[model samples]
Target chain A: MDSNGFRPEHRFDVELVAVTKRYGGTVAVDGVSLRIPRATYCCLLGPSGCGKTSTLRMIAGHEVISEGDVLIHDVNVTDLPPVQRGTAMMFQSYALFPHLNCLDNVAFSLKARGVPKPERHRRARDYLARVHLQDYAERLPGQLSGGQQQRVALARALITEPRILLLDEPLSALDPFLRGQVREELKRLQRELGITFIHVTHSQDEAMALADLMVIMEAGRIRQAGPPREIFERPADAFVARFIGGHNILRDGAGTIAVRADRCRLGIPEAGPHIRGRVAAVEYQGSSVRVALAVDGGPPLSVVMPDDRFFAGPVQPGEEAALTWSTRDAHALPDPA
Target chain B: MIGGGARSRDPREKRPWTFYALATLMGVFLLFLYGPMFVIYLLSFQGPNGGVTFPMVGVSTVWFEDILKPGQMANIPVAFGRSILLAAIVSTITVLVSVAAGLGFRRRFRGSGILFYLAVASLVMPSLLVGFGIGLGFQLFGWKADLFSSALAAQLTWTLPFGLFAMFAVFNRFNRAYEEAATDLGANAWQRLRWVTLPILLPGILGVAMGAFTLSYDEYARTTLVAGNRNTLPLEIYALISSSTSPTLFAIGTLTTTVSFLVIGATLAFVFRLQRRRALARHG
Candidate 1:
């Protein structure tokens, strides 16, 4: 299923049409619709029980459909089983078979499909090498470290060469250090494989780091969907603006303005006429120093300075700093309109 | 086949020494509870004087030869072979039907709760009643069964219930993620079952098979009633013990006991390995 990288002219073209999943009385997914680029890495970002996992499972056919169509390569596969869906999922738990060694686990689907052992092993080993776990091929899942096990899971999913790859908080099980390591590895693998990957995660940074096309969900609905940069800079609603990156959402008559703090510069500009605020709090978060200012022209605004040299030293809490941003960065999202 | 989780660094594991002593005491108690099968084995080789004397008064293969004759000697083998055949039949059917029933129960439906209760009832029912019911049911149908059918019928009484519950226990810790991952990877229902489900259930199935074999093979009362003309080994042995003490009975006892001991020992060993694997999984 490997293909050339996304030709900017081509749309990814995978669609979820009116997908509504109800669990008895509980409506888990509320008629969600999304279209992902063919080779783009799409991320579904939300809090727990926001129907992110349910949506992913629905796509995988692990959950029977209540109503909707999942069109893959333009075919409506609503009644198709998971295997027939031509998609693969990397689970949060990895779900590696304990009895099988890394090689065998990777080759399981192949064996199940009655692929010849020799060819399956060869293909499996190749996928494992891509994950840099070729050396530990014969070791069972229990023998591998958490990160290694995750890679084995990736290899197993990849060996079958499904059209789409689904990741469900795949890095959640790893320790913090291993998490960063595997995240980078997964990003690298997705890039190298040139496959469509739909990742479901609750972590904002993870979504920002890897998403080409990201969907932000709130309370079982698609709050917003776009390129990560677009969603971050121009959210469709207050929920999207707050979720993608923290935004200072200011309500107006027609819509709300979302201004990213880093884009807002604090200086002694046109005092009250522009944006005026007394600094309430200031903290250095390694690379950027965040200055929380109480803006009078609007709601209290937060300003971030990447210019570490200016705010590198101690800055008093009660200092007055006026915040400013170009009209372009301050985009308006119609409040759930 | 054991994994790292088999051994623990916990201080609690050291408490087993105390348990070991108690278990040994209990074993000695059980030995007294069931009098000398051990003594019978020892006395089997007694000389023509009907008593064991240390001076080997010319050991005779007479007892062995006596049990080896066609009418009687062939009887145990026929019965033993019949037991194996019957157990195998029952074990296979038990696994097939129970696996289906168990999967259905786990999946849940309108009547699944009642179905689950019925399954549990099958398990909780006294073996005596099950044998009696099946035997009486067979008689009402005018099915006159010889030893093989009798053993098969009796075996099903225990094996069917045993299979359903053993598999249910195995599924207690099942990960839906496996099926999810498989489905997402493009496996159909059959593929998921064969590649994912069955593999997870294998060790449990093996343990149940051995148990089913033993339960069917060692049954006395059930076999006695259902077995109209058939003299399976258990029935033959019971009649021997009831009528008079015979060296032939001890020989048969030694054979059956050895088989049962080995089966139970292997089952326990496999179960230990599985537990160890699960223990490591818990910490992980």
Candidate 2:
């Protein structure tokens, strides 16, 4: 029914049709087209200023689209406000109302819609319980810990029961340990609610761990969009290969190619391509040992080896080693446009 | 091996020469600030037949009693009431207009810079000149410069800029994310302003209102030319100073200073209570 073949029954929760965002003369999101399936977890992964947050804000209707249309549930929501478009956003800092308690923060939307106090409070309490924050209903956001504040934010965003939830760097403020816990909770909540979530983050690990559909953006354009494993196995270009860490981008006579750091061995292959370089640094990372190779006239590369395999041979810094991987393991990357 | 005989100097025990110099400067500044008011307070209690000098002729409350009686020099009670009414009007208008302008200024628009410079430019102009200009305009228009009209306008020229700058400080620290979050949560513009923005900015708004009221209450130069026939308390006090010097003038000064202190004290207490109510709850 649309250019992206979106239909009501197809149940695509969000679709961006060549959406572009501009500030003055400069473009932030340059004609990006994406379709997020219903109930899927999608991540817009890119470096800072790569337009991921701008794109997310455009989708959430916080930022106006400069060109093209945004559709939600087969409805053209380009001109609609965030509330009318059935989208709610959780800001990077959580943006909880500091003056209000957790219960009031979560009930704010319903109150805005003219819901009665008792009914909204009852609903807000249920939402708080959903986020395991029932006891924190009376506590202000400042009284809560960072993780608790994030959960309260989550409850506030979810109380609207939006068709799509937009999160902008939701875990960047939390400690590393709490990030993992919140990540798990977010995944579980998304599954339980059966709604689409489009998250923006610069961390590739967060994207790979959470996204069912991962979109890698460079500058103002989306470079690749697919499953995490698919992009990991066959990166679309050198930028994608480099942006998605744990992959070594190598140049040869044929073209640029990407091979997983784990797949590359520390010795010359019996009958395949190999490069010789000196070990620049060796880092012990508990489960794995990372060996940085400094090749002459080339970018540095790393090999992540299992700790047991690394200690068995014991390669030290400044030692010469030949890196090789089977041809089958090497995936050729496309040139940049 | 470290020797026990050598001792490390305690940082707190040492004071640089600059510290003593600055301390003396601060002490002198405070004395200069409060010394005149202290003398006025002492002289306000002079006896019935005492002069305005510092000899303190048997301290009593006679000069204070003179404040309530209408004298040939000036009507103290009427001018005092007029001063309060004018200040209330000016304070209310300053808060309304400055807050609206402050919110509008959060976004840069065409000619916004020029508008801001023009508004702030009034602060550097002589206060008497500002009133003179307004009085001239009223004369040209064949209008009477009364207490509420030209006087109120001239006083606002002094207070509005202060109110606007105070709001700039308030909004500089205000997080815009709250507005965005309100929008995302389905709050319309009016609802967002009423329920979120105003409540969050209440403390800052209260401060601006208090500052404007104080500025307007004590204003003399800006209101002098435009005050027409009737006078504010400050103008009446100035008239009494020229016509006849009495301990009653010191009583008026003491009473006004006390009123100012009470106003400032009440506002601070209210703001403190608001802050404490919204402060982070202590955890066990």
Best by TM-score: 2
Compute the lDDT of residue B265 as modeled in candidate 2. 98
| Most accurate candidate by lDDT | 2
- For model 2, residues A1-337, the per-residue Cα lDDT tens digits are 7553435475588899999999999999899999988899999999999999999998888899999999898888899888888899999988888789999999999999999999999999999999899999998887788889999999999999888999999999999999999999899989999999999999999999999999999889999999999999988988898899888899766888899999988985566788889999999999999999999999999999999999989888999998888788889877555
| Whole-model alpha-carbon lDDT for candidate 1 | 0.76
TM-score of chain B of 1: 0.77
Candidate 2 C-alpha lDDT tens digits along B1-284: 12437887798888789999999999999999999889889989998878988688897998888777666634887888899888889999999999999999999999999999999999999999999999999999999999999999999999998999999999997889999999999999999999899988899999999999989998999999999999999999888889888898899899988888998999999988777666633220
Candidate 1 regions with alpha-carbon error over 4 angstroms: A1-10, A112-114, A248-285, A288-337, B1-82, B124-126, B183-191, B245-255, B267-284
lDDT of 2 at B35: 91
State the C-alpha lDDT per candidate.
0.76, 0.90
Model 2 misplaced stretches (Cα beyond 4 Å):
A1-8, A268-271, B1-17, B46-51, B55-58, B69-74, B280-284
Cα-based TM-score, every candidate = 0.77, 0.93
lDDT of 1 by residue, B117-223 (tens): 77667666776776677778888899876665755767676678778888788787677777766666556689889877787777777777776777777777666
**Model 1, DockQ value?**
0.28
lDDT string, candidate 1, A1-337, tens digits: 2342322343544689999999999999999999887788899999898999999988877888798888776667788887776788888889887766788889888887888999989999898898898999887777778888888888898887877898999888878887787788778878888878999999998899888988988788998888888888778877777766567776444567787777777665753224666888877788878888876666566777774654554456788766667666777877564
